[model samples]
Structure formats: structure tokens, C-alpha cells
Target chain A: MSVKIEVGAGGIPHNRILIYGLVGSLVLIYLTYLNTYFQTEYFAFFGGLAAVAALIWGTDTIKHLCSYGLGTGVPSAGMIALGSGVIAALFGATTGIFAPIVTIVIAAIIGAVAGIMANHVVRMDIPVMIVSLIELAIVGAMTVLGLAAMACGTFEFLGMITGTVSFLGFTVQTYETSVIGGSIIAVIFMLGAIAIQHSFNACLGPGEQQDRTLMLAAECGFLSMIPVAIISFAFIGTYAALVALVISIVGWFYTYRKYIVLSKRDAYAWLDAKPILEPKGGA
Target chain B: MEEIVFGIGITALAGALATVAGAAEDTESDIGSQGDPNSQVQLAPQMGYIHRIFNKAVAGEPPAYGLWVALGAGLAWAFMAMQINPILAIVLGSALAVFVQGVYATTAYLGRTASLAKFGQPVYIDILKSMTTVTMAHAFVAIFTTVAMCHLIISALGHPFPLPLLGLVWGIALGAAGSATGNPFYGKERQYQEQKFGAGVPISASGNIVRYAEAGQRNSLDNGFFSAKLGGPASGICFGLIVFFELWRTVVFEELNIWGPIVVGVVVILIFAIIDRYIEVWARKNFGPYTAPEEASS
Candidate 1:
């Protein structure tokens, strides 16, 4: 049932995309900090775009893992990915010291442990399960952290800590920041989850093709930006929201059109008229 | 603070009294209508008290029962609003609602799984594995919508609404919407029976029984599509009302009380429920008995 393409068995080689996505997002994160300290919201907006790029990578990983037909199903992989991702992102963002380093190190450890548990303890039995889980976790975390940087206008540790409530009442003064900044986690979590999962789930069927599936992934990634854009309006301003919304619209249309073309190419038949139906038991 | 406490206590007491009265009336009607000898036994108090409470909260009729649960949830949130950070309050409140909904859905799923096991069918492990993810997705969407609405309120009013109270309102609205829209993917038995369950069970041995077992299954895609359609609008309205009231409170009525938004929410839910019922009927009449053209042709 798998379609083989010249590039690889799938339309795009997973490794190539994964490499591009990983390198691309890390660069964007660094740029986001530079812009926050130097330039304007426009540059930070570019950093937000990095999340979409990471989503494509995440979706590819999902497609790869899910293609094996895991007993737990596709969405479970998405959940596991996001679960580890959110924890990592939150941990990284909130750490007052060496935030980026801490986030990656912790996320990798958690992802590795989760992968081991899913494979050995739960006996999911898929050979690639371990690596897939680890990669998904890293990508998921990166996506969350990246988008959050865009939303909050920086990847710096201080601003991110603005709204956090300390359990020991040490940070009660930060309550205002908590109200404004805390909700960003929730937004990113949902958007990341949808972008990672929806692509494969929507496109899976007999005639499934890799390019089309990836296209759908792109569409979902853009769709996820709608909420981010709305939240941007609240946090940044109308200009930021407009920028995000415009990019999302353009991306969505481009991917959607490509998907339609691939879908048409893959179609075997089309029903132009409704068939007259006789009554069931014998009309 | 004392007045707030007193008001909450009074509202909760009133709601509780009304629920007890309603239950009594419902019990009488249930007995009269069922006329089964075991109807009284069915009414006998169950031992699993916590389970019973969850089942009542999560598994009742669509919007009506869901609204009732939301109302109770709102009251609970009101109590917590004064104590916790707004974000924390929302997280906790929504988490509680989602957990209840998850347990309720899982219970129904277990019953279905048990029935499949009885027939010596190979129940796919995928169903079990994906259950948590599905429930979480539904809950996550609810939380996102709620948070967005809260942000809108804060932005428009230039002040935050009572966090816990808003959370409760969103929780109930979204929770009820989640329950009402329901899972189209797994609810029907027939789809799996034909594709998965029928694989092992011999037709001769099962005879006409296999058809009976398969009767409950519906097309997963159709169910999913319908669910999204119904749920999207219901929750959208809930999100909208939050924005509307927040603006109203800011611009026109600085003193606009909590009751105003809650009351508006109830009316919107009622309208949606009525529309939902018609959609249900329409879907059953028109879109019922769907078979994939490819599958049919094959």
C-alpha cells in the first residue's frame, strides 16, 4: 500500500526534512532573541513562522511512526509527543538560568525515558518506536518554545517568568504577568497538538500519498495559527495579529491547492450523479 | 468577602434543593413509564458512590443535563475565584471538568469493550491506546477556547473577569458542547463489527446474531464530521458570549453582574440544543445508512 517516490519511498525523505526543520528552528530561536534586543516585532514574527516549519517536521515523524500501524493508534503518538513537549517547553521557559540549554537537555531525557517505557514496558513492539518518540518529543518542545517566543516577543528568561506563580508565595508580585503570559502555554499546547496530529489523521486512507499528506500537514499548521493570531492581538497588537493572520492565510491556500491537485491525480473515479436507490428489503 | 461567601452558599443550596426535587419527580415518572418489575431495583442506591456521581454528571441527556453540570461547575469556580491565581484557577477548574468527562467516556467505552470480549472477538488494542489521546484532545480544545475567551474578556474590559467564575462558565459551556457533540468515531458498533469483529466469529455459528451486533456501528468519518459541525458552533457561541459580555461590562454596564452572562449562556445553550435535536433528526433521516462507495462496489 505504500507509494514509492524518486526522492524516497515517501514523497520527501523524512531525514532531510527533519534536518532542515531542526536546524531552521534553532536558528530562528537565536534570531528571535537578537531581534527582541535590537529590531522590531517583524523579526519576532519570523521566529513564529519557525513553529510552522517545525510542525512540518513533527508531522513527517508522525507519518513515519504511524505508517507502521502502532497498536495504540496515531493520535496517541501525537499526545505523547505534545505531553513531553509541553513539559519541556514549560520547564525551559520558566527556568531563570540557562533556559535554552536546560529545556533541550530535560526534554531529551524525558523523551528518551518515555520512548523506553512505550517500547519495553508497554510492549508497543514497533522497532522504530524509541527513536520516533525521542524525535517527536524534541520537535514538539522546540515548536512550543519557538511559538511562545514569538507570542511573548522574546526568548529571554525574565519576560517569560513574568506571570508565573511560585508555590511558596515568593512570586506573588508576578501575578499580573501570570494572567497575561501564563495562557500562552495553553495556546501553544493546543496549536502544537493539532498541527502534529491532524495532518496524518486527515489524509490516511487507501490512496494516501506522501506529498498530499505533507500538504495537509502544512494546512493544519496554518490552521493552528488562527488561535495564535487571535492571542497575538491581545498580547502584541493589531499589526502582529495581521501579520500572523496574513501568513497563515497565504500558507493555507498554497498548501490546500497543492493538496487538491494531488488528490485529483490520485482519484480513480468520480460520481457525477446520485444513484437511484431501491427500497432495502426488496422494493 | 462574607457577602460573597453567603451568596455562593445560597446559590448552591438552591441548586441542590432544585436537583433533589427534580430527581424525585424524575424517579416517579421513570417508574411509571418503565413498568418493569426491576425498575425499583434499578432505583435502589448503588454502592459505587463516586462512580455513580460521575456517571450522573457525564452521561446524562445532551445539553440539558450538561447545562446542569455546568451550572454546578460554575458555582464551584465562584468559590475558588478569590483564593488562587487567575491562570491557576482556570487550569484547575478546566482540568477538573475534563477529568470528569474523560472518566465518563471511558466508562462507556469499557462497557463496549467488555461486550466485544464476550463474543470471542479480537478487540483491537488501538482503541484502548487512543482513548486517552482522544479525550485529551477534546479537553484541550475546550481549554483553548475557554482561555481565548478569557483573554478577549480581559483585553476588551481592560480588567480581568473573575478567573474561576469565568473558567466555570467556559468549562460548562465547552464541557457540555464536548458531551453534546459526542464522539462520532467510535460510538457505532456496526462499522467495527463488519470490518474487525466479523473477521473471526463464524457466520454460521453466530447466525443472525452478527447482524444484531453490528447494528450499532456507524461510519466513523460521518460521525466525526457531524460531531465537529455541531460542537464547533456550540462552543463558538460560548466563546462569543464571553467576548460580548466582557465588552458590555466595560463599556455600557460597569456593574453588570455574573448572572447576566450566565443567563445569556443558558439561553444560547437552549437554542443550540433545540437546533442540535433537529440536526440529529435530519442526519438520521438523510445521511443514515451510509456505505463508502468503494467498499460497496468492492
Candidate 2:
């Protein structure tokens, strides 16, 4: 019976923010399905926004789970979440209209089993580990699904593996896209894992606050979107990928500036280092 | 029906291979002191505890393996497309991947240690020369087996996703399993053996890893010996079960409809959740609280 450690809070409860993240991400990602109707990949940038939301939710779960003295489990938790997520996301993509909902169910199941094994077998004894794991897994799935949608313009497994190219609004060529073949999915996996995990790893301590951490999470998400948006050029086309890149840069800038402000506010004193006067003694 | 049976066979084979890969991955990570616990190794030097632990964390195991396996599988896939022999391509691909792993390990070890030079930590070239090969060797086995498993899933089982994608997914899963399941055994049981067993790491002792061995000062190599006994195999079983159950659910239930596996998966998760709850209660009853009654109440 280890005592659970509590993370500090800002104005809002983490759970409420978590709901915002979950619902916001799911809704935005589901919007990408509109591409099926529009016959264009213009809505793909919404997937990047969805990833940002999922990453925010994931960051909170990690903070909550690691608050229980998980020592070094922070990054591991992130990887595990994304890892299990890839499995669930792939499986879910096989389903037609039910991809998003099915992804949640499968990811939850995988996360639950992994969480159980961690508690009962590994015996970390963290009270919130199971629920946190389940949430992280879903977040991870959404991150993967979101990024894949951003890159491939669709989360369908077949859609990911195949693509068509048009020149100046004229049909030109149909070819196999490299989302899966060239291992762009691998890029998405690492990007999402790092973006989701790096937030807490970078900003954890006794003085850590939720608003600051969540701000960083949002920033990390947008930073991650840069690469995905670039990759989206091959899959989603020039104009759609350009829109994603523009949105990613704008979102990233806003969050980054907000994060810096939050950091300065929480900090006791902020100082810039003076330039080194030439070393007094030679090496 | 035959396809289902064949999927079962492939899943079994993949599971067995995942078991081996999982063990090797954890062992290699333990040898390198790479992951959450690596932070402790980094902090030890700053705390004036200069030790010879091989601190080579290029990234966490999951993403690292994801990169390696994906690279290997991608190259192999390209070679296969070029009409090369599959077995030869796999070997070549894995060898190249292992080389990349070796480079990352060497550079990370050197770079981190050099940064700790301000703390009077010595750069032990011998440890670097010796441990890099050991980690890379284990990494080769893990990477090879994982890429092979991905290949089997793609070619034999006819998984729609290409080899690189499967490699990425399973590689991450393999790393996750090892990190979650095996690392605590190394981090808590082996590294911090001075502490009582089953008592979780206290907040006060976050970066203070055990630096001494039974004989002399401890190193990551010694940690590997202890973790290989329990941690390695536990991770193996964890990963094997995950792969097996995941594929097993699909193979057995997907025929009913797309929802079949999802329904069954939900049921499986619910069952585990109940068991986990029971275990939590039992453990609490048996072990009692770490805090005093008054402290716990407060």
C-alpha cells in the first residue's frame, strides 16, 4: 500500500482538461473522414490538430501516473502508450466507418491488459496506473491515427498503402504511396511518442503546474506536426500539405509563446546569463 | 478455415520470436542502462558518485527499436522488390541496422560521459569498447528477430501493411513490453537492491541509484546479469502474451465480423481489470500501508 503522490494544479482540474482533450481530439480527427466525401485532402490538417489534442491528454495522464513515484516510467509509459496504440490503430483502420470508435475500444483493451500486468505482475503498485494506462493508450491511438490521417489524408489501411497523383487539377498517375512502404508510419510513431512523452520529462518537479505542462504539450504537438506536414506533401499533395505546415507553425508559435509566459510566471526569478568575460585562468 | 489455422500458426511463430526479441531487447537495454533508470546513472556523476555504468540512451527502447527494425525491414523490402534472395536481404538489412545501433550507442556513451567531465567522471574507453559490442550483439538478435517476424506477418500471414509498418508497430510493442515489464526488476531489484523488496521507490531517492557491487563498484554489465535471470524472461513472457493474445483474438474472432474481435477484446480487458482489482485488494490487505495510520488518514 504505497501512498499516492499528488501533482500540483492550476485553475482547472486535470480531468476536466482531459475531457476537453479527448473530445476535442476525437471530434477533430473524425472530421478528417470528410475527405472521403470531398474528394480532396484539404481537411488533413485537422488530423494534426487532433494529434495535438491527444498529446495534451496523454501528457496529463503521464503526469498523473508518474506522480505515483514511477521514477523513470515516464518515457516508458509514453512508448508503451504509442506502441499499443499502433496495434489498435492498425486494427481499427481495417474497419470502414467505425475506425475511430473501434480504435478507442481496441486501444483501451490493450492498455488495460498492459496496465494490469504492470500492477499485478511488475507490481509498481501505482493506484491510478490502470486508468492512466487506458487513457494513454487511447491517446496514443488517436495520435497515430491523427498523424497518419494528416500524412496519408486517410486512416484506412488500404488508403494509406495506395495513392493517386494529379497535375494542375488533371488526373496524371496512380501509384503506391510510401506511408507504409517507405516507413512514414514509423516516423509518425516516433514523432507522436516523443511529442507525447517529452512534455512531462522536460517539465516535471515539485514546482510543476498543469497549465505550464499542458502548454508545453501543445507546443510539442505542433512541433511534431512540422515533420508530418512535410511528409504530407507526398500523400496529401502540395496545397494541403502547405496548409498543414502553415497551421502547424502558427499553432506552434502561439503555444510556444504561451508556454514561455507560463514558465516565466511560475519561475521565482528569471535571469539571462551574462557573457563570459574571458576566462581568468588558461585551461 | 485453413487461412485461420495458418494465421494461428504464424501468430504462434511470431509470438515465440517476440519472446526472444523481448528478452534480448531488455538485456541489451539493461546492459546499456538505457531508459528511465539511465537518468539515475546520469545524475550519479553530478552527485559525486563517479561510476562506470554504460550510459547509452540514444532514445527509449521502444522508439529506438522502432527505428532499427523499420530500417531493417524497409531495406529488406526494397531488396526483395529488387528480386534479391529474401534470407540474404534480411541478414544484410539486420547487419546494417546493428551497425547504426552500434554507432548511436558509442556516440551517446561518449557524449554523455564527456558532458559529465565537469563532475570528474572519467571516460573509460575500455568499458566503451567492450560494452558497445555486447549491446550491439544483443541488439542484432532483437532487430533480426523482429524484422523476421514483420516479414512473416507480411509475406506468410498476408498482413496488408508493408514490412516497415509492421516492423514499426511490433518494434514499439516489443520495446514497450520490455521497458514496462522488465525494467523495474533491473531498476528497483537489481540497481537499488539495498532497499527492501516490494517497497516502491520513494520520492526522496529519485536519482540515487546503487553504485556499489558485491565485489567492487557496480556497472551496467553486472546489472544485466541479475536482470537476465528474472527481468529478461518476464519481459519475454509479457511480450509473447501480448502478441499472441492480440493475434489470437483476431484469428479466432475476426471471421464473425469486424466487431467480433473488438467485442472479444473488450471482454478480455474487462476480465483483466477485474483480476487486477482483486490483486490490488489482496495486496493491500496483505502488505498494509507504507505510511503510519495517522499519516495515511491525513
| Model number with the top lDDT | 2
Worst 10 residues of 1 chain A by lDDT: A269-278
Give the poorly placed runs of model 1, Cα more than 4 Å off: A1-8, A94-102, A163-174, A177-181, A270-283, B1-186, B189-298
Query: How accurate locally, in lDDT, is each candidate?
Result: 0.48, 0.77
Report per-candidate DockQ. 0.01, 0.06
Docking class of 2: incorrect
Per-residue lDDT tens digits for candidate 2, residues A72-143, read: 566678889999999999899899778988999999999999989998999877799899999999999999
Per-residue alpha-carbon lDDT of candidate 1 for residues A115-196, written as tens digits (9 for 90 to 100): 8998899986778788888888887887777777766566655655454334465635463443233444554555576457
For B104-153, candidate 1 gives per-residue lDDT tens digits of: 33322222222222122222223323433453444434443344344334
- Model 2 — TM-score against the truth? 0.56
Clashing pairs in 2: none
> What RMSD does model 2 have?
12.2
Estimated TM-score per prediction?
A: 0.53, 0.56
B108-217 per-residue lDDT for model 2 (tens digits): 56545543444555556667777899998888888888888888877886778877678778888888998998998887777766556665666555555777677866
Worst 10 residues of 1 chain B by lDDT: B46-55
